[model samples]
Target: MTASPSSAYPYRLRLPGPITIPERIRQATARSIVNHRGPEMRVILEEIQQWIKPLFGTTAPVLTFGSSGTGVMEASLANVLAPGEKVLALVHGQFGERYAQIARALGAEVDVIESEWGWTPDPAVIAAKLDKNDYRALVAVHNESSTGAVTDLAAIGALLRDRDTLLLVDSVSGLGGLELRQDEWGVDIIVTGSQKALMCPPGLGFASVSEKARKVIERDDRCARFYLDMRKALAVVDKHETAFTCPVSLLFGVHEALTMIHEEGLPQVFARHKRLSDAMRAGCVALGLPAFGDQATASHTVVVASVPEPLTGGAIVKHMYETYNTAIAGARNKLTGRVIRIGTMGLISEADVLTDLYFLERSLTALGHAVPTPGCGVAAAVASLS
Candidate 1:
C-alpha cells in the first residue's frame, strides 16, 4: 500500500517563506502592468538580461522565457540543427535521454553514447564516437538528477574544442549549484531553470548561447517553430524585450534572487553548495548506506543511496516525511524501490543535513530496519568536510 500524502511531513527544515521580495521591485511591479513594447519595459528587460549574464558566467546575451527548462532544451536543438543534421549525444541518465529524444523529434540524427545510469560518461567513449561521426553538435547533462551523476564538463569541452560540433549542455540542476564556466568550457548552448540553484519559484527558463551556436542557428536550413525559435528570442532581446508576454512576477522573483546571489558572491555560494553536498554524502555513508553513484561521479545537488532490501526506498521516504516532516526524492525508472535521493541545493544548510540524518536513522529503526548510532551520519559528513 502507498503512504498517504496528508501524512507526509512536507519538510523537516522550514524553507524561508516564499522568497522575500525586494521592496523596490515589489513596489515597481505592483504598479499597473506596463506596456510590453514600451520604453519602460525595455529597461526592465535589459536589466534582467544584464543580471542573468553574471550568474551564467558569460557576457553573451542570456535569453529568458516564461516557460519550463524543457522549453529551452527544445529551443537549443530547434535553433541550431537543421532536419537530419547529426548529433553525438552522451547519456548518463534520464535527462540525457530526454535530450536525445528532443533532438530526434526535431529530425536530427542522434548518435548516443550510453553509460550506466549512476556513472559519468567516459570521455574516451565520447571521443571514439566523435571520431566516427561528423556530428554538428554534442549534447550532455551537466548534472544527471535521476542517477545523481556529475559529468566532467571541462574534459568534455576540451574534447570538442577543435571539432566543429557545438557543445550543448542541459545544466538545469547544475547551474549556480555547481561550478560551470560557459565561456571557459567552450560550451555553445547551456540551459537552466529558475527553481534549482537560482532559488526562485519555477516559471522562468534561461539559455546562454555562444557565437558558434548563434552561427548555426543562422545557417540551419530548417525553420524553427515560431514560439520556440531562438533566433526570434535573440532578435527581441537585442532590442531589450521578449518575443512574447513575459512572466512579470517570476521575473521580479528572479531579479530578487539574483541580487541575493550577487551579494553572497558566486564563489562563496558555490563553496557552500559543495560543502553541503559533501556533508550529505558523508551522512549517508555514516548511516551505513552505500551511495548509488560511483564516488568519483556524484552530483553536488542530489545524493542517491542504496536502501536495504526489505525497507524499500518508498517506505524510507514515507517514514522520513510522516515521522520527521522531511521531504526527500525517491528513485525513478529502474532504480525505483532501490535508492533514495537526498537533495542539498539552494538554501539548504549543514544543520538541515544533521537533522535529516537523525530522522533517517530514527525512521529506519521504526520501520524495523537496523541503523547505526544517531549521530553517525552527522559525524561522517563532518569528517568528509575536514
Candidate 2:
C-alpha cells in the first residue's frame, strides 16, 4: 500500500501529478469562473495558444480538453485509428501499456514491443518492428511515470521521418520538463496534461496536432467520439472558442501556469529539472539507494531509486509522510516493494530536493536502514547541484 495523505492538510505533494502548486497558480484557480464562450474566455484561449505552443515544440494547433492526460491520449488515438487498424505500441512501463490498451479498446489491432520495466524501448528494436509491420501508427510514451524512465523520442522520431506511419507521443510527464521538438521530430500528435510539469491542476489535457495528423483526423470517421473529437475541437479553437464548455477556472490556472513557464523561459525550466534530478540521484546513491533505471535513460522529471534490502519502499514513503509531512511515491506492479519515486517537476526547487533527501536519509535510518554517512546525502546532492 502507498502512503496515505489522511493525516495532513498539505503534505508536500511530490507525486507526478497534483504536485505542489505555487501561490500564483493556486490564486489563478480561485478566480471566479467566466463564460466559457465569452470574449474573456476567448482572450485567455488565445493567450494559452501563444504560450503553450513553444512548450510542445509545435507551431500547429494545440487542442485543450476538460479531462486529464489520459483523455488526450485517447483523443490522439481516436482521431487517427480506425477499426482493426494495426498499430505498434512501444511498451516500457505502465503508462505505455495504457496507451496500447486504449488503442485496443478502440478496436485497433495493437502490437507491442515490450521492454523491462526499468528500461526504455530501444530505437533499433522499434525500427526492426517497423520494418516487419505496416502499422497505421506507432505509439510511444515520452516519459513513463510508473518507472521513471524516459524514452528517447528524438531517436524514435528519426526512425519515422519518411514513413507513412504516424508517430503519436504521450508526453504527459515530459512536455514542460524535458526537450520536445514536436514538429522538427516529425511527431504527428503529442499529448500532455496540465497537472505535471505545467504546474497546474489535473482537470486539463492538451494535444498538439501536426498537419499530417489533422489530415487524418479530418478524413477518419471510423472511431466514434464526441468530447474527444479533434475536428470539433480544432474548428472551435480556431475561433478562440471551445467545442464544449471547458473547465473555466482550471483554464485560468493553466493560463497562469503557462505565463510563469514563459517568464522563466523553457530552456531554464529544463535545466532546473535536470539539476534537481541529478541532485536527487546523487543524494539517493550516497544514502545507498541507487537509481532504479538505467542512468542514461532515466527520467529527469521523476527520480526512481531502489530501497535497500529489509526496507520496503512503502515503509520509507509512509515514514517520509508521517515523520516529515512530505510525500514521496512507491512503485507499481512488479516494482512494488523495491523502489521509491521522487518527483522533481514543476514548482520543485533545490531546497525542496535537499530537504527531501535530508528527511529521506533520516527516515531510512529510523526504519533501521543504515546510511553510509550522516549528512552525506545532502552533501552529495549539494555537490551535484554545483
Candidate 3:
C-alpha cells in the first residue's frame, strides 16, 4: 500500500473545500444542463435567492458569479474600492492575507494588522486601529481555513458600527457552517463559495451586499471592471438573471444542496457543524495532536492540529491517503509541513469522523509517532459525538 491510488477511486474528501458531495447533490449535478437565460434557469435562480438568504442572515441582494470564492472576494473589493483609497485588513492566516492582497491589487492602499498564524485578530486591536485612522473599509476573514481559527465577526462588526468603515468579510468557508448574521452584524459585504459547508461543487461564488456597500459601489468608478461589476449583477438580480453566463449544472447542484440544508433546518445544520467540530477536536487531542489555534474560537468547519515531534505533517497526510484511502490537508505557507487540517464541514457525519480518527491514529502510529492508547482517539470522538 504505497502512496498510490490503487482502489481509492471513491476516497473521501476530508479537505476544507470541495467536500464530499452527497449522493443526491451529485445526482442533481449530473442532470442535463439547462439554458442559462431560460424560464427554468430563472426559477432556479429565484429559488436560490430565497434559500441562500438565511445562510448569510441577510435579506440584502446576494449576487452570484460563475467563479470561485476568490472571484467574489475580488468583486467585493473592485466594486467598493476606489484607486488610492485607504483600507484596513486584519490578517491571521492565508485566506486573510489573500483578502488584503485583493484590496491592494484593486489599487487601495491597504494597511494590514496581522496576528500570529493559528490565532484570530483581536477585535479591540481592530477598534484601536479604526479609531486612530479613517479607512474606507475593514476587511477580514470570518473563518481562517488555513489555521482553523474562526473570527468573531459580530464583535468585529460592533467595533465598526459607529465608524464609517465598511465591514467586508470573506466567509467562503464559514457561511453555512458558522453563525453569521450579516445584516444584524452590520457586515457590509460577505463573499462565499458553494464548495465548503454548502455541500456543493465549486464554480459558484456568492456575495451578500448591504445598502451601505451598495452605495459605495455605486459611487466608485475608479477601478476597471466588466463581468465582476456589482452594479450590473444587482440590476438583473430582481429579474433572476446574471450579467454573464451562469453555471447551470453547478446551480442545479447548489439548489439540491440548499434543499437538503433547508430540510435539515438552519439551526440543526449549525448544531451539526458544532457537534462535528467538538468531535474532531476531541479525537485529535486524544491522539496527542492538540488543536493548533485558540480552542475557544476554533472554527466549526475545520479542525487543525500541529503534527507531533519526530513526525512531519506530510508523512501523516501521505499515510492516511495511501494506506487508508482517506484525504486530509496540510497547512499553507508559514505553517506548511507543520500542521494537518481535518474538515468537519458539509455532509460529514459522526461515522465519517470516527472512521477518519481511527485511520488517523493508525497513520500516526505507523509514522513512528506514539499514540497514547490504541482506540483512545476514536473513543474520545464517540464521547464527544454522544
Clashing pairs in 2: none
Question: What does the lDDT come to for candidate 1?
Answer: 0.80
Query: Which prediction has the highest lDDT against the true structure?
Result: 3
After best superposition, candidate 2 residue 280: deviation in angstroms? 1.0
**Candidate 3 wrong stretches, greater than 4 Å:** 6-10
Best-fitting candidate, scored by TM-score: 3
Report the Cα lDDT for residue 310, model 1: 84
Model 3 vs. true fold: TM: 0.97
Ten-residue stretch with the least lDDT total in model 3: 1-10
- Candidate 3 at 113: error in angstroms? 0.9
Q: Each model's TM-score?
A: 0.90, 0.96, 0.97
Candidate 2, which ten residues in sequence have the lowest lDDT sum?
A: 1-10
Q: Which has the higher lDDT value, candidate number 1 or candidate number 2?
A: 2
Ranking by lDDT: 3, 2, 1
